[model samples]
Target: MNALFLTFLFPLIGFLLLSFSRGRLGENLSALIGVGSVGLSAATSAWIIYQFNVAPPEAGVFTQQLWVWMSVEGFAPSFTLHLDGLSLTMLGVVTGVGFLIHLFASWYMRGEEGYSRFFAYTNLFIFSMLLLVLGDNLLLLYFGWEGVGLCSYLLIGFYYSNPNNGNAALKAFIVTRVGDVFMAFGLFILYMQLGTLNIQELLTLAPQKFAAGDPWLTLATLALLGGAVGKSAQLPLQTWLADAMAGPTPVSALIHAATMVTAGVYLIARTNGLFLLTPDVLELVGIVGGVTLVLAGFAALVQTDIKRILAYSTMSQIGYMFLALGVGAWEAAIFHLMTHAFFKALLFLASGAVINACHHEQNIFKMGGLWKKLPLAYASFIVGGAALAALPLITAGFYSKDEILWEAFASGNSELLYAGLAGAFLTSIYTFRLIFIAFHGEQKTEAHGGHGVAYWLPLSTLIVLSTFVGALISPPLAGVLPQSVGHAGGEAQHSLEIASGAIAIAGILLAAMLFLGKRRLVTAIAASAPGRFLGAWWYAAWGFDWLYALLFVKPYLLICRLLGRDPLDHAIGLIPATVRSSHEAMTSTETGYLRWYAASLALGAVVVLGIIVLA
Candidate 1:
């Protein structure tokens, strides 16, 4: 089998092993199978990368068609695999980082009642994500898209005992479906316009075949953007991610931090060819991304739940990536995606360790001085926090984030640059706020700390990777793309770098001043008006459950009630009751059943005879 086939097949093997074994396999063995499957996929992916570098694909893209999966009057979709610079980068992130998270989950989920089920879902999620990146056609990509959605629903609702967990899962699915509808329409538009779903064909034909600024292209791009927005949890659709914290911590680490959420960035980057044809749509991407970054950063600032804070941070970080893709810095955006995955996964996993140590208390206010008790987690948290803050010169986040900001400025999109910088400042405050409140203060909770190797090993590995992966992208990933699509020189200027660094430092200092210095004063301020607003995420996240109730549940109930008493129903019921009465009245006419029946038959025969005679 080819390398790409092996890369996807191993995960499926794991899913099947765990799924078929169900109640037969021991928990530890099942966990091993799950982690091992992804481990194998990661190794295969590494081999694919080696092959790619050694003997790069011609035409700057490679495709392998397995067979025609479907054919009709005018449409055909094949089972295909595509390898390009973009897909290779995403493959490394999904499989490589995904494997690490699986290892971490093995520990985090140990001894849980549904450990086997957890691994099954994780393996399935990885397989689906791989398919998403590797598909050569839009139809195949959509298959992966829906596959991930299915796996997400299953994993999110893994704790089916809790009504809240089910609700959260439903909310995520239903909300994203709204965007999926638009995405489906966009796909249909492309098929109708171009008569093919193959991404390679579409990209090749897009420049000359589709006119610049065509309304159809604009509509299709916008529709696709809607899907991205929903999946990435951008803007109004973001509330579900915070509520998603109802799942297990490991689930949060995998689905929320590392893999599933990045699908939006991947979508935009993969379709950059089409997006390039419509500059206006691309600008809109920048605007939406910038707004989401700032808004989510503010939301992160006030969240008391450790996971909720990180959830908002995930939204903010993804916004930055989208902004990079928007302004034509595809490489920089993807670079940031790789970096974000490492640090964000580290943060969430380390937080899991902390919560586990603290007897499952997730409120940051209730946690303090955990650094001494869980030193490994503390170290990982600090490293992850530095990345989140994008502190100068040391963290991987600094390199990727600064590159994006520099590109934004050079592109002369000042509004986006300013918004992005403002979001950066807020990011610093919120990240450190969680760090200080949870790890810096006097011990506020009883700490039962005996974290095993299971906990520390994964965090340590991620910490090391997060510290060094940023520099590799410029070299390893650079050659994968065509030179034309690679980092263009005019984008990353020295002056822009210095300015971005200055702004980032200022933001970090501001965070330190507000949270670390005069801590009690900050608490008192939070109790007051402006701080309360900031803490409440500016009320954008308020009454979320109630909002759903008012908008969906209540209206649906009202409609059902109205339909129950409709005029048609009343008329039908009256007719049925009258028909029953008429039947009762007619029953008396049949008292002498045989004679009456014979008389009726004779009368009918005589009438027929008379009509025939007249004719």
Candidate 2:
């Protein structure tokens, strides 16, 4: 526990050293600093976890206060780190999975432009996320929250030469900012009502200060949920994620798996006390999750880009975590968050490998039958895909996702439970859809396999974790969060699990039948009028981007065009305009001619004499 500060220190050092070097360092040295720093943080995290488990803190929480950040009339928040099962779980994910992603990134980004720059941004991302989960107070957490947003903008637009990439980055930043604004308002409400931003303190005082279903509390929780939705990429704010694949694949993995997208789930779970009081907001969380999962699933089914498929899958998976949070399954939510980091990271990294192997081709339809050529990537896809599809009993995803479904069912929310089941079915279809299309069929293009320890090591490790082995590592969330509500016993839980598992397998079989052969049947369906229309709609992510453009973007741009002259600026410019005009008129008499100059001087002198005499 004493060494907890080291977790942040190492990553900060890595970011500073890499950033200041400004690409002067050799790629090898840069990779060493970048990967080594995160590795050290992960090591420190493991040791802290050991210490924590060996000697559990009194009251199951520990706070390490560094200094008072600021004080204004007793409104003070400290630069403090809070540790408990929840933060610890997230800490492990951030440092552990984060380190693996950095290591794999070294291989993936080796010869790319701005290699050092890539690592620097990723290092900063990890540092910011660490700050977010570790922060004891809302202000500190919000600082981290905003920090990651900035980092995502930098990394997502890492390839700034492309206008599309820049637009994608801007889109991500702006969409998330909307949610951040809501979160800020929520923070203000909490502080105004209960007078503190410290998370533990706020949770302690919330129930006592406001009764359940209080309007203010409900508003505050809803505001916080808004922030979560934006960050987590749920529903209306989800359009940016697919475009975010315009960046490098490792950037995709880091954002999708380890850091930015999961922040929302963490927020809701961390502030469960407040959410519990606002049941309406809590149910909304589940509803958003339910809708997002099903919609994202459908969208993933139509994506041609391998990375975009994974991006939508991430949204759907986070939707599951949100659903868990909504149903009072606190541990299940965090548990799924952990397992999700493992497999989602694997899938993204493997997709990077496949893209590299196939000569930078991203469209899955462009290449095929690479199982022999790119065996590592094929195996990675298989294992990660299985985990994603929640192949019963043997994969990490099965354990986590099955728990979410059970919780949903146990809560008596049949709609949500069915949504989870539907998402499971869709997951299998899309997961295998990518696999069967990209790894099976006739070879469409030449491919090469990735070689070297850096490339294979991360993939291999994640492969192991994506299995049931990962599920064995249960989150240390006992007593840190409220015990889950309405636990369903033996027979009921088993039945739901089996049903979900069967649905997943059924989806995979359907995908195989549709895609594993000539793909003629799918082609015909896609060519048909209704199928084409539906396919295009899903491929465009149900036209959310278009809808948003019509509703918000077009109107805003129209207003900008209408006010193109900037009325306020023109109004302010009036004084300067008048002064310039008067000066020009006066200057007309003093032309660049000696006679004119002399005349003007004489006239001025006469006027001065007349004024003096008159006075």
Candidate 3:
């Protein structure tokens, strides 16, 4: 447990040393510190996990109580780290994938201007995510939650000289804050109703204290879902992530692959008991996941920027996780979460290599046939794309994603299953659309070739993970989780698995037909007005952002402008001047003269008597 605690400390220390040194440490040293700390943390996590597997905690859980955080009357909450299969699973993703990203970043960010500052933020993000997953109580989790939000804003706007980057950072911060508000309210409601913030306590107490369909419990669950929606980039709150690509590519990988976006899934999965009580809220989770996956999948299809394409893909894939959670496929959701991290990180890092090789060109339309120039990256991207499309059971994504589809179908919700299938199709189409357009076309630009081991190593590891990690880890993960969570087998019929695979193949062929050799139908479709409109709608994320702008952003901006001479200022102006004049008049009455005193007394007496007589 102490070693588990040290996992967070290493990154925290790394961030502090690098940040406070103020560039005196130089680029190479800063890079070493950042990557080294995360690597060490990963090592420490492995050791802790090894120990846990050996001894096993009582009831398969371990809690490290560092201090008594707060107490009032009979209420108390402590600074604690709760480790179980759930937290350990998340810890593994955060530390393991995070370390790989850091390594990839050490190369990707090599000599960037804000090199030290970049690593500082990266280390801090790891520490924050660790706290977020490792916390034992809601307050501690919120602390880490807000920490990651702040760190994300900093990292996203790392190139702050550009106003667009700054605006993007602010957009992410403000949009996520909307969900955080709901989460805060949810916490308050839960506390008021249940009188506890400790997660295990709440999990134990909620069902015992409240019956199924309790309104207060439902509201609390819904509120928490709002937070998940914002963080996970589920519907309505997903607009920020596409813009978040303004940061360094490694930051994009970190956020989309391992950290902030996955927080919502972890949150929902952690409090499975609470949600199980509210069937309606569970259904809402599936609805949000299903709708978001479809919309984001559409958005990914039309995106030109490589990172933004991956961004929308990240959103859609998270939707699958949400769908799994909704259907009580907890193990499936977590499995997808892990596999998605491996493949998505691989895609992002490989995309970084492509972008670098092409002199920072991010538009997939501009990149062509790097199959020879940067064969490693090209092959890695294919693997990532294959995994993303869940190219039949060979890739990690097939095993995980098909499980979600099966779970959705097994739940007997035709709508969810159909939506999941649609999302799968869209996912495959866009994933290979980018692949075929970028990898199979005539060389549009000459690419500067050759990357160091620093670049190739991470991609190779992730390529392997994306190809096979799901099958390797899914069964072990199932054993790790509670039995009631639902497994990949049993009622998750084989027929549905075949159907999901066929749909994935159909999408790949569709992408190849439209984008690869002869793009005849795609060209004809692009020429039509209806096709143009649909493309625009998909590009705009189905106008959800527009609706939000009209509903929230425009009114907010208008209010800010109106506040230049705020109504409060006018009312305040009236009060202060009137007070000053009345004070001056009163000062005149305070003169040390018998006549003035007598006059004041007489006036006061006259006014008092007049009022008394009227009464």
Best by lDDT: 2
lDDT of 3 by residue, 244-348 (tens): 999999999998666779999999988888898999999999999999998889889888999999999999999999999998888888989989999999999
Candidates in order, TM-scores: namely: 0.91, 0.95, 0.91
TM for candidate 3 is: 0.91
> Candidate 3: worst 10 consecutive residues by lDDT?
475-484
lDDT of all predictions: 0.83, 0.92, 0.88
Name the candidate that leads on TM-score.
2
Q: Give the C-alpha miss distance for residue 175 in model 1, angstroms.
A: 0.6
Q: After superposition, how far is residue 239 of candidate 3 from its true place, in Å?
A: 0.9
Candidate 1 lDDT (Cα, whole model)? 0.83
Where model 2 places Cα greater than 4 Å from the true spot, the runs are: 566-615
Better of 1 and 3 by lDDT: 3
**Alpha-carbon runs more than 4 Å astray in model 1:** 450-453, 475-492, 537-553, 581-615
For candidate 2, the clash count comes to 0
lDDT of 1 by residue, 1-615 (tens): 166888888999999989898757787898789999999999999998888878887865678888998989968899999987788888888888888888878877777778888898889999999889899988998888888888888888888999999999998898888878888998998888888888878878777678889888888888888888878887656767887888888888888888888888888887877888888998888888899898888778777899999998999999998888778777788888889998999999988888888989999989988889888888998889888888777888988988788778768888988988888888888898898889876888987664666667778878876775654555244544222222454635666667666776786676667766457777789899877776665545655557777999799999999998999999989988999999998886777779889998999999999999999
Off by over 4 Å in 3: 72-74, 475-492, 565-568, 571-615
